[model samples]
Structure formats: C-alpha cells, structure tokens
Target: MRTMMTRRQLLQSIGSGFGMMSFAGLEAASDPLAARQPHFPARAKHVIYLFLNGGPSQVDTFDPKPALTRFHGTSAPSGNLKTERKTGALLKSPFAFRRHGQSGLEFSEIFPKLGACADDLCVIRSMYTERPNHEPSLFMFNCGHVLPGHPSMGSWLTYGLGTFNRNLPGYVVLCPGVPVIGPQLWTSAYLPAIHQGTYLPNNESEPEKLIQHLRNRNLSAEEQRRQLDLLASLNRLHLEREGGDAQLEGRIQSMEVAYRMQSEAMDALDVSREPAAVRARYGDGDFARGCLIARRLVERGVRMVQVYYGNGQPWDNHDDIQIHRRLAATSDAPMAALLQDLKASGLLKETIVLIGGEFGRTPSVEVSGLVRVQNGRDHNNHGFSILMAGGGVKGGLAYGSTDEFGFKAVEKRTHPHDVHATILHLMGMDHTKLTYRHAGRDFRLTDVAGTVVRDIIA
Candidate 1:
C-alpha cells in the first residue's frame, strides 16, 4: 500500500503536526488529522459570524446592570479587576436597559430592535480572553490562538468540510479594510489555499471591482477558459500520477469551480436586484450592504460568512463611551432583521448567526476630564459577552454572565475556546477530532482547551 501526498495533505499534516508534545497537551480528542469526520449528526449546515471589529461594551448592549445606575461615578465595589490604563472611577451607564421579548431578555436602549428578537439570542455574557490588547484578542477570537499563523475559524470550517456547494467558496469574509491583526485571523495557515477565506470589501460590490485578479481583462472568456482547461489537464495528470493528492485534486476542482462562480457569485452580489423595501431594512452603509450580500451567499450554499463592522479599532471607544450609540445603531437593526428574515424564510433552522467582538470594554472611564456624555472603556478580556442566534440554538434565552459591574464572568463563564468548540459542535464537527499535523505535533482549533457547552446546544 502506498500513501500519496498533495499540497493540501502536506499542509494538513503540518497543521496536525508530526512533532512531539504538540497535539498531546490539547483537550481535544486523540486523532487530529483523521480525514475530518463529523462529531455527530449535524443540526446546522452553515454559519454567519457578525464580527463587530472593535470590542463592543457588553454593559451598553446585552448585559444590563441596574447597579451601575444606582452607584454612578464610583469604584467597582473594591474588586481585583484592573483596566489597561489607570481609571478614575466606575461610570454608570448613561443609557438605560430594558427587558424585552417573551424570554424577557435585557438590552440597553441602543438596541430596541435587537431586543425585540431577544428570544432568538443565546446571550453569553461571560466570555473572556487571554489578552487585553486588540491584536492578540482578535487573533484568539478568530484563530483560537494568541499567537499569529494559526488557521482561522473560517479556514478550519472550510478544511473540515470541503463544502456543500463547490461553485461558491466555502469560507467568505467581508470587511471594508484591513482589520486589527490584519489577514492572519482569516488565513488558512498550513491549510490548503482553497480553505482560506474569500475576502470582499465594500468596493467589491461592483462586478468590475470585486476581486483584483478574479476577472482577467487581458484574456477574453474563451481565452481564460482555454488557459484553465490546460491547467486542469496538467493538474489532473499530476493528481492521477500522485495517487490521491489533496492539493492537486482541490486545484483541479477549484479552477472549474472558480470559472462557474464568476457569473453566479457576481449575481449573488448584485443587491440592486432586491426590492427597494428589503434594502432599506438592512440600512444603506457599506457594512449593511455586506450583510445583505451574506444572506444571498448563505442562501446559495456558502458555508461561513463573516461580516465585520467598521475597520481597524472602530469599536475601541477609549475616550468616550457615549459614542457607542453610533456604533450600536449601525449593527443593531440589521442584525435583528437578519434573524427575522432567516426565520421567516425558514433559513434560520440551518444557518447560525453570531454577534460580538474580541472582548468587552472596561466599566471605568479613560479620557481626560471629558464630560462622560458617552464614555469610552478599555479592553476587558476577563469577561465580555456575545449574542448567538439561528441554527439549532434555542430561541429566547441568555447563557452565562459577568459580575455585578459587568467586569468579570461569575457564572457559566464561557471562554473563547468554549465558543469555538460550540461553533464546531453546531456544525457537527468534533473540535477534538478536527486536527492538522504541523512541525511534528498535532494542531487543532481548540489548542488543548475547549469543551462544547452542551446546555447551549438545541
């Protein structure tokens, strides 16, 4: 018996590792690179991650604490929690929180529409990170590693599942510009190039500006077709001779897939085709447009769609927290409408929608004597919050939480690793079992610590 190797296999081997002490320490299951099998029967087939680029303050959004109002401008009741910069005093939330929906979930005044869909959200208020800074936290949030170079969550999903639809990419990421930590978060790392995310910015709206090298102006369709045909023949020959080469086979499949996708993907991108009424509901910003495009792609079988709000550190409200009103307004309605639309169209059952950022803002004020109309908060990886909906997640419930001042997670603390595990679980992939071997050690997305929170699973 002979074993064949291709770029995909080689990279996967590197991902899982052939080295010592790599995969052994992780909490995941034994075999990390056993041909990517499903953990159990899958309840959902796709995922849409509404990545809030800057960390959104949980207190201002999902987790509402009345104590902040009662004790305005004071300390955090003498707790060990510390902010990045020395803070003056605890600032009370200028915005009030209200309970909404049948589940009676609580949300700040900024998100009335999202509050209307509270029952659909599994709000986890106790999510923490290993770092307080933006770069590492962003990397950790998307790649399960504080260090760079690991495969992103999107890349992992694409690698684990080749994709239900070959015409469109398995992993799609939408953002206006470079984000914190740059492309590392969505990178495929050691995975095959095909598994990496297909990034589309706001300018990609038009077919002419969508992808840089995608549409070749130099060659006509017939010419490009001939080039791809020739390349496909060479790749197939290499694959046949190599005997089960993952990379070569993937390339062969990818070229034809790319060719088929040009028109189809462009068509899905054309939101103008949608009714005027539907477009208004999603808002008119570039981010909102991306969200609408995401819906179309997911409907057409794209596996994972991550629509990031704002560019680098927009949510980093260090000086004035009051300004979050603008940020909150940008994300709130479109997210709620997305949930309702998915539910109404029956797509929610098979699609998972998640909203949150790397971490939450600190409870204290940070700017110089600026009147705290809307104060800014520092990064708090100790305990932030995230809102999850659709897919198999039960409607109308909140899971996990932080302490009284919304500083740290006290009960049902859900770490980023746990969230990763749960996301994998929702897609029916066992986090422990999904491994890639790299540098002689087995590598997994969980990186030695993760357990799918069964309670949150519907």
Candidate 2:
C-alpha cells in the first residue's frame, strides 16, 4: 500500500531533519486548553465574577454617604462632576443604611441578605474608571481596555492556566441576554479562540436550550464518538499539512470539548438536581440560577465563570435610581447564597468572588426633559464601589473611600487595571510578565499601568 502525502507534508518529512521536533511542538499546541502551571503558588484556583452589567450606585449600595443625607435637595458640595448627562442637586439614597456583621460594614436596606455576610466582604469604595458610557466602561472592566480588541480577564486567565476539566471550557459567561457591549466584552481577540469565553444564554433552565446543539440528535453516543474520531483524524492531518493553524486547532479542540460536555454539562447546569432547600437559598431568578451554575462549574474545576447581572445594562439607572432597589432585590440573595455555599463547601477558600458594576451613579440627581427623571442619577466615572470576598483577600474591611458626597475616589484610589492585576496575582500570575506579543508589542492584562493593591490582600 502506498501512502499519499501533500506537498507541505512531503517537505516536512525531508526538510532539515527537524520535522519530528516541529511535529512534537504542533502536538503540544494542538491542545491549547490543556491545564498548565501558574507562575507561582496560586492563592485562588477559580474565579467567579458577578458583573452587575450596568453601573450600580455606590452611595446606594456599599458606600453610604451620610453627607448626601445631610445635604439632600441641596447642590453637591463638590459641585457636579461632569457626567454623561445633566444633573441637579444631591439626591440621597432612599434606603436606610445600617452597619452589619462584626465588621460593622454598612449596607443599604436593599441587600439584607448580603448584609448578613458583610463581614466576609472587602468593600472597595474608591473604584474609578476612565469612561462613563456603557460600551467603554464595560470594555474597560472586562478587557482592561477602552477599545474592543483586547482579550478579557477570563481569556487571559484561561490562556495562562488553562483548565482543570477538559470536558468544560476554561472560561464560561452566563448572561440571560447580550450585554450592552455584546460579545466584545468576552472575546479573546488576538488570543487563540479556544481561550475566549463560552457564552451560555441562561435565560432558559433547560440545558439543551441553554447550550444549542449540545447533543447529537441523529447519532447515538457510540456513533457520534466514532464520527468524532474520524473527524479528529482528518483535522489532525490538515493541521499537520497547514503547520498548525490556530483557528483550525481551536475548532478541533472546541469539537472535542463539546463532545465531552454532552456527558456532563447537563448535570452541571441543572439546578433542579440540587436539594429544594439549596435552590431556595439561592432564590428563584435567572441571575440566581447563574450564580448556582457558577458554583457548580467552579466546583467541577472550571477556571473562571462570569455571571452578568442581565442584558442591556440593567443597572444603568439614569432615569430612576430607585430601580437599583429592584435590581438589588433580585441579585442580593443569590450573591449572598453563593458566598455562603462556597464557604460551606470549602470552595470559598480557593475561589475568588467579585461583585460590582462597570462604574457608579452620580451623587447628584439627574434632571432630564421631565420632572419624573429628577429621581434618577447620571453616570459617574470618578468613583464607585466593588466587593471582593474569599480568595486570599482580607475580609471585614473597607479598603478605600470616595469623597463625602461619594463623587470621587479620594483615598486609596483603584482602577480596573489594578483590579485585573490583583486578580491575576491571586491566580499566581505576575501581571507584568503575563504578556502576549501581538502587533510587535507585548500586551498584558494591566496594559501600561496597574499596581496590585497590597492592602486588600490577606
């Protein structure tokens, strides 16, 4: 029997005597999602980012500004900081704030469930970003860039450490609907596509609908396995001839993951499998369900899971800041339950949990064309708040502060890049060294500037 070889393969068999070595390298590259070691001992093995989708009001959530209450209906002491829209006098948070837990961490009435777990939270009240618009801010938070082409933090982590479970993706995104910035927020961009986040529109609880084409409808399990074996053989041949094209390699890897997922993903995503008490603890809603799935995925050794609060910037309350109360009601219980469950299961020690939005709302009231909007607040990029828990962070502490009016980050200021750096550091990666060379320059998650806020570290 004679074996036919393509021109590239023929040359590879005879060229430079390094074909075997090159082929070995190609074989390693073929499984880019294979688990790899981190730069050092990792503090956190997994990360769960509970992105609030839109800008949540800092004063109304974690950072309670007593000054706002004192000066209600009066012009802000610092005057109106330029925001996305016109604003009026200071608007106090309607929900009363009370100190909770042994830490005495103040929380608004909207997050009663979270308040019970306040001691476990390290609230950063001085978070700021460069933009106020939804697109740029979302990009900044997710990708560390104001532009759209950078890989997200999840992608960077996946590329750095890969995944523990080959059956599941390294990075998964759960959103009931597309966010304001769409898929760009989770895109891998210049990185291999395999590192990009696998988005699951979790509006539906059924695993089959949540993940389209998850099962082989026509072929039986064994038949599909045989077909996949044949397909992989062909793909490997094409990959060898093409000298390991990244896209082709990624596709091949994706197909294998999809195949393996058919066996386990359904069970992982099925919230009904949990005890009724457990399900009830997390509450009943899409966001709550996503939190549960995040826990399950991380428990199964998935590297990163991001649960976007909702589609189309639900937290962007430019009209009625009261809407934040409603949004918080929907998310607070699940958010708290996630932490409690992780702690109870011992996953909290190794899992990083982050809760925040793109930015925050202005301290002053926003005045639009009508009087009805006077209760709303405009977008404020100067300052905000975010909560971090477990994953080697110092709990029962508030690390930073906004001004008296909650208008600006006055002390221990932090940026999105800093957050990225801190997260990578927790994952045992040096943000400065975790670079991917593209366009003739080595790009990192922190970009040009970011200092890991050591104060927040445990």
lDDT of 1 at 35: 32
> Largest lDDT belongs to which candidate?
2
TM-score between candidate 2 and the true structure = 0.93
Candidate 2 global Cα RMSD: 4.8
Model 1 per-residue lDDT at 433: 81
What digit string (tens of lDDT, one per residue) describes model 2 on residues 1-458? 01113324644665655334433244354456778788889899899999998889999999999889899999976579998888889999998998999999999999999999988899999999998888888888999999989999999998888889878889999999988878898998888778889999878898888898898889998888778767766776676666756677677667877888998899898888999999999888899999999999999999999999997889888788889889988899999999999999999989999999899999999897744657888888999999999899889999889999999999999999998999999989999988888788888778999999889989
Pairs of residues at least 3 apart in sequence or in different chains that clash in candidate 2: none
lDDT of 1 by residue, 1-458 (tens): 01124544543454534323221222023222223446688878889999887888988888887777777787667753665665657777778889888888898999988899988888988888888888888988899999998999988887786566656788888888868877787988877656778788864567446655566668887887778766655654464456655455555555665776766777788888889988888887877887888898889888899988867878888778877898878777788778888989999998989889988987776644543443667778888899888778876778888888888888998888998898889888889888888777888889999988888877
Per-model clash counts, in order, read 30, 0
